[model samples]
Target: MGERANKRSFTQSGRGGRGQGGGAHRGRGGAKGASPARTSALEAVRILRERDAFAQDVMEKTVDVARLSPEDRAFATRLVLGVVSTRGVLDEVLNRCMRTPHDVTPDVRDALQISAYEILFLDKSPHAAVDQGVELVRGIAPRAGGVANAVLRKVAASKASFPFGNPAADAAAYARLHGFPAWLAARLVSDLGAQDAHELIKASNEPAPLYAAVCAAKATPEVEDEVVADLEAACAAPEPVEVDGARVAGCYRLAGGRALLDGRVKRHIANGCLLVSDAASQAVASLVLPADRPASFLEVGAGRGTKTILIQSNAQRRYGAQVDGYVTIDNHGFKTSLLADRASDYGVHLEEALTGDAARLGEAVGDRAFDVVFIDAPCSGLGTLRRHPEIRWRLRPDVVTDHARLGLSLLESAAAHVAPGGMLAYATCTVLPEENAHVVASFLKGAHGEGFELVPVRGQAAFATRVTSGGTDGHFCAIMRRKAL
Candidate 1:
């Protein structure tokens, strides 16, 4: 049992700057002992390193059950995300300090990574961070304490000397310092240009802004900030601000709060019609319904049903009675049930919750049937680094090609369901051209080209570029009109 601490506070403090150590000390338990929340966060990081789990998924699952104090929960969340964000550089530091180097276990690696991450990224004292890290290891993996302590201490001592070179020119150096797979590094540098690519990599290593959409059904634009503030307050957010509207409308940014889970936050999210979404997700959904006109729509890949809710909310607001029915589909039965449940709550008559693959979903619908088909294709989700920091280290460049192919398959299949004179949209949260424009481009090169025309994304101001500014999540959306056959 770790000591429990009073609620800690976080501040907006600006975008901590590029490649700078923006880490800070999260106070340990104040009275009884260090809270279990702190330990749970540490343990989650360890599990990630030891078990090769995705940090975001691991943290999401762990935080739900950790029974952490609000402050402790926030601390733990930050520690886990920070360590993952800087894992490449942290790994390099650890490798240099190891005696046998290769002898470290996953648990030990996880512990050491947390410590080194704090030393390098946060404002915590190296000695205190290292000591706490060693203690974390002792409780979880007593046998590996000695090795963990030695390696972490060495990391603390040599924190000033880590080297992360340009991945384009030096792939090995890039991988070691940035913690990205070699292929991803090469692709980023190639597509984004060297400087922009490096900046993207650096930005991915930072915390992303947490956002919430005020359910327009319950709130208006004037009250969006109030809703955002109330939710942030309920979550004990260190920093919360209203950034932008969601894909449907009425979205606000809860800058520093955890996206999901937290005793205080769980209540806040459930209380209102707020949907937690990044700006990119909002923007893509917006593109699908850019006007105040009703159209029959089908959403492919409506996992857990968040997007379905966003779409209905948007359509009802913009088109009112003019909006037609929404038919959502996914391969998983559970997801279909989940979507059905959520849609029922929103008072939306989901045309149907069908079970089918995205690529083949068109077969389920008659020819030239849907006015719009939104294929929010699944990909690496690299653009969501701030929220899912651990992904960078675990994501391999090879996955991009596979995802691109899958995305294309889904797009091609989706096009068939799109009625003549209707629109087919392809989108992903990934920034890679391969999974984005390139994939769409390649798909267009095939026979699909004859039937569809690319429709440019309508609102650029609402969109964020992959370089310079750190506004929205990475997303690529291409709308195509189905040619009258």
Candidate 2:
């Protein structure tokens, strides 16, 4: 028997899982069998650490997350995401649990982190967590199992009484207690205040359910409701629920994350009536900007064309006219190919889809101008913490602060293509003011932006603000209009 003397069932979480606790009083002899999911998780973590790979991108190539049994898939997803989301806190606890945490090999360290996650947070059986951890480490490192077992035991003995203290009283301390990065913690405190910051830090850890938009470009004007109904029919269990009042008119919410629910939704995505996107992204693409009608529309960084579809839908609604000329641009040829595919799938006609560096817009379209030019610029993804947890660890402070350079170059090049009386809308899935507000402000002050004036994100809806949470990614958008000739 281990410190957790009694067997316990897994905790019921919005995260959704029903795996048995690691298993009770197993001791070494009763340890669980080799877990494919756990093994996959270890490999995923290695790729994330050594290769700096995004979890979703690397998971399929390495682990085949879609093929795992539902329970095992859920478990593996939780373990990898949970560990990455709280690496700082996990390291903090590891230091306290072991005398020389630094001496542990990277393999053992990862295994320990997973074991610690189970013992401290999950409803896993303590003995099972330990046994599985030992087995994992022994398999990976050959000689580290004994130390790994000892460290996790100490962690189990003490994890129940974590001294988180009061979050409102000390934001930094509160952040450390929960595994959030100190820099981001301070920024959250500055942006959201102490209590809300604490709440957000924790809330960001919980994965939001996937949201899809009915591709209005692909379907009739009245197809939104029908699309929603058909998607609901595709669900086999518990019945899909209709989501309404999303910032984007055609958006619907799915209860579970998208990667987990491919059976029903995958085909729709292929044909393009439904597209998976975060609500905030939909809002950034459609909820704001182009306050006036634009005869021609140009979108930069049109990755996969999710936002391109949203932009077109918004333009059609805003102007009551189909844009005369629609041009989509991206720096990557492959992404441009994807954009072309999406455009074809959605049945949206594009006058041109150009592949060129945003800073070299002239090279692609040869000095063409349009009614509206949109730059969904590359950003540090700070505002998207809820969706892209790895960004927190991967991003440097330099990228978040004074972040105007990359987008500014694009903005500078695109400025020449904005017709008089036209508008330029700059948006990013980042909370950093440098990337969002500062970049826009700097461009407005630059040589090409002499007569450009910033426009409100919500037009006449003065009181309406950006959707910051509740299954939304954090976003910052700035729309600026050029003076009429």
Candidate 1 per-residue C-alpha lDDT over 1-485 given as tens digits, one digit per residue, 9 for 90 to 100: 00011112233111121112222223221111223544666667656766766666677667546655555555677776667776766776788788665878766677677667777666567777766677666665667778877878777777665444553567766755655656677778788788877887776655565566555544455555665566566663523332234233565555354435465455545654566676557656667874646468888888777777667766656666424567888888897897788666655557778888767664666564788888878888767665566667677767778988898888777766777888887777777777788877877788866677777654542233462345666766788887887
Which candidate comes out best when scored by lDDT? 2
How accurate locally is residue 143 in candidate 1, as Cα lDDT from 0 to 100?
A: 77
Which window of ten consecutive residues has the lowest lDDT sum in model 2?
Answer: 1-10
| Model 2 lDDT per residue over 1-485, tens place | 00000000111231222223232222221223436556656677777777766666666665454346556666777777767777767777878888876768876788778777776666577788887788777767767778887888887787655535655576665676666777878886786566666656665666654666677666566665566665666552222322234346666666554332455456666766776676667666664446566668888888778787777766665666556688988878898898898788876778888888778888888878888888888887665565566777666777666456888888899989888988888878765566767777788888978888877644531112232335455666677778898
Evaluated at residue 155, the lDDT of candidate 2 is: 77
Best by TM-score: 2
Evaluated at residue 257, the lDDT of candidate 2 is 47
Model 2 error, position 146 (Å): 0.3
